[model samples]
Target chain A: MSTPYVRRFDSFDRVLHGFLMLSFLGLAATGLPLIFSDQPWARRMTGILGSFEVAGWLHRVCATMLITVFAVHLSRLGRRLIFQRDFGLLWGPRSMVPQPRDLTDAVGHVKWFLGLGARPRFDRYTYWEKFDYWAVFWGMGIIGASGLLLWFPVFFANVVPGWFFNIALLVHGEEALLAVGFIFTMHFFNGHLRPEKFPMDRVIFTGRVSLEELEEERPSEYARLKASGGLAALQVPPPERWLVRLGTVIGTTAVSIGLLLVGFILYAVLT
Target chain B: MRIKHWLAFFSVLFVATLTFVAAKGPTNIPMKAPPAPSRPAVVKAPPEPANDDCLACHGDPDAKSDTGRRIGVDPAKFTESVHGALDLKCVDCHADLKKTTDFPHPSKLAKVNCAGCHQEKVAEYDRSIHAAARRQSAGSVAATCVDCHGTHDIRQKTDPKSLTYPLNLPATCGRCHGDPDVIKQGHIQIGNVSDLYKDSIHGKAVSKSGLMVAANCTSCHGSHDIRKKSDPDSRVFRRNIPNVCGSCHEGIKAQYDNGVHGIANGRGNDKAPVCADCHTAHQIQRADVASWRLDTIRECGTCHADKITTYRDTFHGQVTSLGFVRVAACSDCHGAHDIHGKADPRSTVAPGNIVSTCRKCHPTAGENFAKYDPHADKHDKARNPVLFYAAGFMKWLLLGVFGVFGLHAVLWLPRGFRERRGQAKHS
Candidate 1:
């Protein structure tokens, strides 16, 4: 038996998420040309970007959108924590601590991979996922704060020593290198490289889960929902099941087409 | 029926509210006109008094100064002055009329700046190092015109009493410039040039003990047209140094350019010596027996110490210090302005041409002596390869030995907390 999978994100949250993703991607695309300016490819990239002034305006607009989305997300989180009484999910005392058993499990997993032991039991969220999420949060905070400092440099010039600007430049560049490296190497490997999840992960969009998936992947959360008397909602009636299935098919098809269009446009422009 | 009635009534109310809001929006209020400014009132005042009566007493020719010097009011001579030429009255320069009891005397006066009149001469003077110091020490009794020329009876060279007259120039100019007390007080560094020039090769050819016809104050400073060295139009500019000196030392300048020192200076090397550095201005003498017995290299070595030390360490200096006439001082390999570097295609000491520049004196000179940089000291091992090899090898061997020892420290040193944690668990 599985627990009911409530829609996790509101409409506002989904819209904000989309805006953030678009702007972040736009900034990265526009900024890379300026970074590798000495290369011949940079010239071609700049040309495709249509004049630096227009590109600059587009980048700033995107940045503003990203910041607005971040503010909205923060407000939602604040409301959830204060008014909605959902602080238990976040700011709850964490139990995902490094323990003797966790160490043993980690060692066993490594051993299993080496053909020296059986695979260890795992829980709902892996240590690596927690690390990646926290890293992104820290990266966003640092990059955002440094960017604000750089944006209004004259305000700080009177209070801060000149050397701080040099330090800010160094930190901005190195932090960017770390973020890009992690995104391409570790995040891509973890998020998109698994065989079953290989071409896509649709759960973020649908905000749903199957009984078998809940049992296999999130047994602890499933058990909690069952204890909380939410399991009845998990069993969909025959008529509602068809409706949900139809919704999923249309939604997935629309999303897939949109993603392909974006990819094709990008390919045409970049080349 | 009630729902339909309420919806129709509310729709009519909404339309009425929308119409009201539209009526209140965007009225183009006319701009208010700005107030006109009032004109300023003019204030009238009294007229200036006349000074025609004052000129009566000042126009007298028999008037004498309190110190008994004749204060002859020479209108003609005064008119020739720049202030007079500019139509400036004597009263413009003088003030303090209340205390005066004399006629043809300045009622009051301020010290005159001749520069206010003679602007071009002042500009030329200002750019020279002498005028550069004037701002700092303006009140110092330094080289003013009256110090060389008499104040009341100043004249051109044609006048017998004129300080610039050919026979009298050196003695007249030297009187203040050569006085040990005056020179010391003024901190003038061109040491006793008036005395020394009186005895130079050119000096001996002239008639008097203290005067030279070929060279005098005006010979270098120019009669009345003396210009500053900073001006490119001036004869004494650095770029024109070789040619200026060559006017008298033609044979020497030709030979000197082939020498290394002249070659460097011609290429704009500030470290290279100018003609004045060794022989010196004001104290110049012939490089004959009286001076040759003394080490010429010692004089040149004041600035070229490393070269001096390097040359001393060589066989050339060993013979030269002992008074060998053929030994080099600085007039070897680097000709004057005609000099080009070894890198230049036309260079006399270029690898292809070095044999010839050396062959002028050393017919059998090998390439070894020609390749050596004469300015370099033997102890400067970085430039001297044999010493560099010996020192560098020993230093690096020691560093390599120490580096091997340091690796032991690095490899086992905690190896960061992550590796330490793993190691502890394994143990």
Candidate 2:
């Protein structure tokens, strides 16, 4: 078998990705007022946020951040495609495609859950996880394009028909619902709600694979890494800088609290 | 002593003589009847009693006719009535019944007419067209107490079974006016006037508001003396139109007097729009609903068809079809009851006043654009060239966008899902 490369995301990529997620959360929080204007408590929230004008400004700022992250990420991807010629990174390989063997493996995994079979031969990434990643990209593209049009209505009015506003409203609302549903249900299950992960996973933060974790979770990637002598090169020194460590600790705590509050408020409002 | 003896002897003689005179005196006088009236004149029949109750003093069939039961009504039935329950009696209305049943029936008994008992209400009713027409037509279907109030069975209006009860009066009056046989026999024009009234705004509001002043059958037509419309003395006559309609619409009438429609029509000028011209007298309705407004338009279009046709083709009309209800109607700008020609100073549609009037419903309407007459139709020349083309263009544009996006959502959404699935499989 050919050796596989295991390159960890650099610090800049990790921080930028974190900023993108944070900005996304901010946009969602502020823009939701338009969706929930009729709700009684939403009135109070809008009032506190200084009515529609302020909410609109906050949404615009978050959108700007999101666009910035998108541009940076796109440039990085372009560099990889042009200089590194890493097109295979996107498609991975024929093995990445979900196959009939995946169904068998999935069944075996379920059986293992029931203590009936050994853990199935999961490759570098599970089919469900792969599905979620692509859905995020699809959702972002549609929602972002529609949102931009809505944000700059006067500009769009010159080019677009007035009727497009109604359509944009429908798409934006539906896409938002889809994004929220997936993030809460599927993403939560794959990333946070698992028995091993429980509340969260550290992989996204450390951006490093442990020897044991790699062996168990992605044995094939681990095997290829060993062959290519890339495993030793993949060391991240566990965030040795104290300020960075403390900052991460505080940031995670704050983000988690904020997320929990958002979830609770959403629950109260919906129910 | 001698004087006392003599006085005793005299007293004995006196007693003997007095007893003899007393026994003879009454027998000697003759009995004679008192003198009657100097010239005997013929007497007329007595009048009916006015008391709400006829049974109290007269309940006994054998009750003395000379005194207590002088005024005659059938006491047997009266004793059984709801009036009897209240303990009212005949002697209350027939105040002089005990004195005499002499001819001319003692006007002292309050004359016993319903008008006599209810003078103020009766006087007001007398002024109505109904009363005047009845008087002029001379007993032509002239309504009296017995027509509305049953002769003996006149229950208090509070009783649901009474003819005057709110729920039952319509049917009660409809009995004569609505009945085909009755109408035919009475030479009355036949229609479901009552059914048509139930559809009117006044009829609905009378029921909802429970306000007695709201138009009921008796309100438009005088209660006691409904008159024919042809009578000039009638309240509904053209000369008396403003006063009759102004009873409820005083403010509108005052405004209309300064308007073009209120100008005199005889001196070589064309006829002005009167109350009935715009708002049909009996068929008046609230114009809030689009259907009602459209009906109003059609009514106005009878005289102003070109304007209506143009109005129908506007953007406002198109949005109305799209179910955006807060759109403009004729009355939205034009005063409803007090409409006038645009030249009149008091007219709502006059150039100086139209903006404020339009702004009542359309807060965003431009001031200069408001005065531009929406109803002016270049009758056949593709009316309101700018507004017509613009509204049409917008309508189609909106329709197209909705259609395109709907199609995209239907076709591309699933395609997008499939493509994402393919990408997921590859990754």
Interface root-mean-square deviation (Å) of every model: 24.8, 13.6
lDDT of 2 by residue, A44-70 (tens): 666688655676688889888888887
- Model 1 RMSD to the real structure? 36.9
In model 1, the Cα lDDT at residue A10 comes to: 45
User: At residue A239, what lDDT does model 2 achieve?
Assistant: 39
Show how many residue pairs clash in every candidate, following the order shown. 14, 5
lDDT of 1 by residue, A1-271 (tens): 4344543334475566557556766665554444343334444555676655555567677767767777777787779778987746453222333346555655664565455765455544554455555555666676666666555444555455433443344344345444544444344444433333444444444545565556655565567666877666645422245545654564455445334433433344466
Q: lDDT per residue, candidate 2, B1-427, as tens digits?
A: 4575445335434544544556555642121111111001112234333232244444445545544444445654554444444333344334345244443343335434544345665776677544554677764564555667665456666677677776556667776666666555455553667667766777776656665567667655556555555556666656566667778878888776655556553221335666766566667777566555656656666776666665654434433332334567666777665667789776777877876786686555455335344553333335345444434444554355345434423443344355447556876
Model 1: CAPRI class: incorrect
Fraction of the reference Cα-Cα interface contacts (below 8 Å) that each candidate reproduces = 0.00, 0.00
Model 2 chain A poorest 10 in a row by lDDT: A1-10
DockQ in order? 0.00, 0.03
Residue ranges of candidate 1 with Cα displaced over 4 Å: A1-13, A91-112, A115-124, A232-271, B1-427
